[model samples]
Target chain A: MVIQDLKVLICDDSMFARKKMNMTISALGINEVFEAADGEEAVAKYKENKPDVVFMDIIMPRITGIEALKQIIEFDPDAKVVMASSVGTQGHLKEALRAGAADFLQKPISDEDTRAILENAAKGVL
Target chain B: MFAQFFGGYLLHKKLVTSEDLTQAFEDKKHTRMRLGVLAINAGLMTADQVEHVNITQQSVDKRFGDLAVELGYVTEEQVDKLLSQQPTEYLLLGQTLVNNGVLSNAQFEQAINDYKTDNELTDSDLEGSKNESLNKLVTEFYHLEEASNARMLTDYVTMMFKNIIRFIDGDFTPLEAIVIREFDAETLIEQRITGTYDAVTCITAEKDVYFEFAKRFAGENFGDITGFENETVGEFLNVVNGLFAVNQSNEGGAELTMTPQQFIQDKKISFEKPAFCIPVVFSFGEVDFIVSTE
Candidate 1:
């Protein structure tokens, strides 16, 4: 799989976060991108799109990213949902990994970090 | 960070108006640090001595450092040491103010000295940005030592400024904080930290200033996106509160979690306790950050 062929879903309540990440991923030459404003939409979108990778924020209005991650993994055990959040405390980190998150990134994610994640996903390593 | 607090100090002392600060912050980017300003900041030369050197340099081709040494104002070693040092942000701001004539060299000397002495900041403290010194500065600036949960308030405000500098612009002046029980907010986002202790944090601003702040954080013109201004501001509050929670959990053995942020517009919100409303003036406008530890 090449980087441009990857399908990515971004789940964040903030339109700012989603739009910023979308621009960066699009700049990476990946055209297939999906967005969700909360965890409910995230799970629905994940099941509908079955994106190659998901960037999920921990806090959202309806359901949290962690709960949505669990639902996605339950729907498809191989779902790649990375916890991209502000709170990367020990408890959140341990719980995210326990819920089978592929990776965890602290908030204020740089464009470089996004690129690295996509590269890993393309190589089947994320 | 010291630069920002120094700006705040200047504002508090009435040594410089907010307009002076705004202009100086803008002008500092192009202002080069001269040996005269550095020597005065280092206390090795008086403002009059630096003025004399400036006058003498107009007639002679000698550099400021050589003339200062030759005039017995500063020794050769002191001149070399001052010139060898890198210019910190605060020094650059001071130099800009001096150049702009907003502050006389004497006023700059007095303000810098008093700022250091009042905060009990050593030269190393100003240069190195040690956390202990920052905590002291925050506590002193807000008069948090007399407030309930002083330590927690100090820690939170200190971290807030750090994040503001990290994510937003560093060219902001933090106004003196005031304790308030109620506020009629034009635009506001509130989040709660709960667990071993409870606290509420909020950011509020006028509509235009709110949009400007959201624009700064989002790094885009939000004109096309409907409801983007509120969401961007809410996310900033979320990020700051989340980091504060993580810090508490890791260092203090206090497990904390944040409630989803709530956005309110043109509403009256009252805190159960007296919240410290810290108004920070950016080049764009003033935004108030309110925190109450319950």
Candidate 2:
């Protein structure tokens, strides 16, 4: 359950934001990170890698985070998928948590949040 | 962005009182303006650096320093000295509000973290809340009409610069005293901008439109809140343009083409070209902003 040698998957539409998140997680030494452009790709990558942790943005083109979350969970009942969303996505957070996302990270992704989510992701696996 | 927009909505629905709404507005007003002052006070930029950029950006696509060089205001050496003085503390939304007593420092800090947790926002997501009507107008016009993804990127720029400038020269004004002005800057935007935009144009008595659209767009066409804001700023700019050009005759209409949005966070970064940009100052009730360019 521990993310030692953990593989991370980042799913979002913004290349700039995805780069920022990758850099932060990489700085934390969470190497072996994978990337997906939207919900469908995220679920596909999740299936391909079955990464220990996933950071999914709820509102992506094609399939949404919620739909993908459900799909990922269905594929792997223990899939650890966290969400990357804006603060305005408050209402959806409850639904995400209910839908089985491990945790959520806010936008303008920060070091503190990366640590928080990763830490929690470990807890979710255990 | 989340607080002001939601506070206004809650008030409108009578979920919260006018007092709560006013208090939040006052806090935002102080915070947004103070970030600029703090950036200046910290020597992030000299008065000349800011003023020179402001004056030049009014007419050029280039950023503050590019024009500073063109105008001989400061040398590259001086720019280096000033860049080191970035007001990291001041640029923080919570610190600005708390430091000014709009909210106690502790309270402001708590609210910000809570806001972050409550909203699950990334910084880029929060950046969308910082734009005004003009940017919104551009968002709609550029994204919808032109159908370019490039136009959608302005949210980050608007958020980062939302506090970059304020109407320091103006004092508090009421609804009766409020005035709206229009100008012709077609020569600078570099693109042939004709027609109207509307959206981010309405300041919502403060910067409360963030939540209004957040609520509206979250469940509809956009993804989640972050995705919603990511897309909204561009649309908002177009909406603002629509409202702004509501009455302009074609003969008197000003073409307002938008250049690609560039974010100059903390320090001054210059655009590479000259652009026809509009400078608009607005005061909604007692709040004020000096939007020189979108």
The lDDT of each candidate is: 0.91, 0.46
Q: What is the DockQ of each candidate?
A: 0.67, 0.01
Candidate 2 residue lDDT tens string, B1-294? 233332322333344344444444455445433322333433344444555567668888975555666677556666555455433321443333444444443343344444444444443444454344434533432232332323333442234223222212121111111223432211111111132331112222123433333333223334433444433433333223322332122223432222222211123222222211222222233222213222
Q: If candidate 2 were superposed on the true structure by all CA atoms, what would the RMSD be?
A: 21.3
Model 2, A66-104: lDDT tens digits are 889999999998888887664323345668888998777
Model 1 residue A45 lDDT score: 96
Candidate 2, residue B119: how far the Cα is off, in Å: 32
Give the poorly placed runs of model 2, Cα more than 4 Å off.
Answer: A1-4, A123-126, B1-294
Top lDDT: which candidate number?
Answer: 1
Q: lDDT tens digits, residues B49-135, model 1?
A: 899999999999998888988999988988778778889999999999999998888898899999999999988899987778999
TM-score of each: 0.96, 0.37
Off by over 4 Å in 1: B58-61
- Each candidate's interface RMSD (Å, one decimal) is 1.2, 13.5
DockQ, candidate 1, vs. native dimer: 0.67
